[model samples]
Target chain A: MKSFLQPEQWTMAAASHWLLVTTVLLSVMACSSVPAPVAELAAAEQAILTAEQARVNTYAASELAQARQKLQDARAAVVQKDMLQASRLAQQSKLDAELALARAGAAEALAVNDEMKKSTEILQQEMLRNQTGVKP
Target chain B: MNYLKRSAPTAVAAAMSLMLLGACASKPATPEGVINARQQLNKLQASADLAVLAPVAIRQADAAVQEAEKPTKDQALSDHLVFIADRKVNIAWAQAQDKHAQDQRKLLTDARDAARLDSRTREADLARSDASVARNDAERARDEAVAARTAAEQERMAAEQARSGAEQDRLAAEQARNAAALSQQEAESANAKAAALQAQIAALNAKTTERGLVVTLGDVLFDTAQSNLKASSSSHLANLAAFLKSYPERGVIIEGHSDSVGDEDYNFGLSQRRADSVQGYLLGQGIAASRITTAGKGESLPVAGNDNASGRQQNRRGEVIITDAVTASN
Candidate 1:
């Protein structure tokens, strides 16, 4: 809170202002060159939410956990201002979440197929028995 | 040289940036994950078994693969899309498998039902055929039994007829045998009578000659060519008469023969007188006149040669012959 209006303090303020402006300009240029991964992060979050909604915890628990970890990594990359790495991690998270959702869907389909197969087998055996005049 | 030295770091930084941008621009020709997703989608589309059953799933997988294969600046985004697409393809494949299995099971069930129905139909047909065969067999057996019974009845009737015929034949044969025996008895009785007659005739020294039963009175009985028979000859004539009377059906012939001792006419007259004398003696013994015949053989019918006295005496004879019934009737 000391007065910076003295001649020596004024020279120090001028050098500091020049350095701060250069740093701001460089930061602005870097921000313009590398955009934020806002869309990818949102997509990853939506995918993870969808995986959870689809009961991936039961069918693809490991994949869902990996997706959540990847999503956390993407957020850390965003905090570190690593736009490219953030984008990559968000994408990886989205992919993992999608994979988890797909695995859940596949598991559900496989379970249904197994049940159908069992029913079909029983039906076939019963039909065979009937045809052969054997007791069912 | 100083300018070169001053621009070296910038040049290197520019080159590195260029290389980085080049790497970013020149992406992998095809992402393996996306390619794999595309291949799985293609396979799902190609499946005909699941076309109708999982049409929606196949369409979704195809859409997801197309999305995944899209060129993007973010490789991770591409990978993520590819992963989702691959999973979608897997989901589509799973759905297709499930539906395909269900359809196969349905088809098997239908076939099994049809087979059961066919088996039942065949069994029913066999049963009907067996029933028809049984009926035919029963009918045939009944017919055979009826035919057998009829044959047995006919045989029994034939046997009865044969028995009656045999009985009749036996009675007829017995009657014939009885008649034969009666005839044989009659013949034996006749033979016995004939034998008795022959015995009586033998007592008179009678002999069976070609003419008939002949009782000869030698020249001794005629008394030296006299026409009259001697007393010894009367016994022979008496026996002949008695035989002739017993056999009324018989007749008698009185034959006289002489030796060649005189003229032929005188010998013939002597023979006739001797035959008439024998016939008169038989008539006196109660033999009917009709039952007697007389003949005279002159010296031509001499019984012996006239070379000596004994031969001439033997030739002079009076014979009484009993004729058969046939000759008598004639």
Candidate 2:
């Protein structure tokens, strides 16, 4: 409530406001001029590479294709200067690649489970038959 | 670097919202993609068995869902967040399921091992029992064989005993038959001897009486009054002597009788002399002297009345008595 403003304080405050304005303008310019989502894009590409390495393209081809498409779309967004969309699309691409890898792994795991189940069943049946055969 | 990129977008988005705030009076609902992502994440989180399996992935998925659920005016950004969230949730689930399946494989492996071990154990048990059964059968067979051998041995011994008993019985019967034959031969010989003795007695003209066989010699067998055996009686005396020789146990008693003539003492003396003459004749024929005896009866014991010459002649006789013939022949 007391009037504590002085001339030097006002001069310093105004100088600070100009600096702040300059900083805002610079940040706004940086935002509008779309820096490509280089890290996110690289992450997505890396995820795709990992999925391909895992042979996800063979088992989860559709998901892998979608991930590839999303990565391409992210590149297109970067070219179009839509930095936010490019980042989002890159993230989505990465997630899609991961999903493809996850799907492929799940499919192989389930198949292995089925194989084991069948093997166990065969063993059980053989045991039963052996037990029954003894009676004769 | 990524953080800076993201914050820059938020600032831009906030500015755009402020500009659009005048046109839109109310806030927008959460995007369908975000709702879908939230639903998927909720399902993943509800699974306790799956949630704990991939802790880092689940945490990432949770963060993605929360970011997607944040009310944002940017449709593209919301869609990207939703997709990332959905994929992350699905990835978490896939990873959890993979881990779960691998974990289950351990149990399955154990089960398979158990089954294999159990099968092996059963086979071993069966083989062992079979061996035991075979052993029992073999032992039983051995025991039966031993019992059979024992029975056979006992039967053989019994047969041997029976054969020996039969042989003993046959031998006894043969001995009895031999004894019977010997006795029969002795009896036949005795009967023949009795017949021969009877013939000898008849030849002697001996008479049987209570005393024994009696052979009487007429007075002519002696000299008129002298005591001497006449030669005419030699044949009859020889027969008697032969009988006495054949039966050595026979004892002779010679008695002399006379007619009522002369003095009694003189008559007795004459008879005694006549008995002595017969005994002397028997002794000459080889009769034992110990088996011969002589006695004389005077005219008082005459067999007929001495009033007639015939009666007197009948009374004047020497009698040879075989006293022990019946007893000695037995």
lDDT of 1: 0.75
Q: List the residue pairs that clash in candidate 2.
A: none
Per-residue alpha-carbon lDDT of candidate 2 for residues B25-113, written as tens digits (9 for 90 to 100)? 66876777767767777787788888788889989988988888888878867777787788888898889888888878888888877
Interface RMSD, prediction 1: 5.8
Q: How accurate locally is residue A69 in candidate 2, as Cα lDDT from 0 to 100?
A: 96
Model 1 chain B is weakest, by summed lDDT over 10 consecutive residues, at B321-330
- For B107-218, candidate 1 gives per-residue lDDT tens digits of 6666656655665665676678779989999999999999999999999999999999999999999999998999899999989987988787777687887766777888
- Candidate 1 residue pairs in clash (backbone atoms < 3 Å): none
Considering every candidate listed, which one attains the maximal TM-score? 2
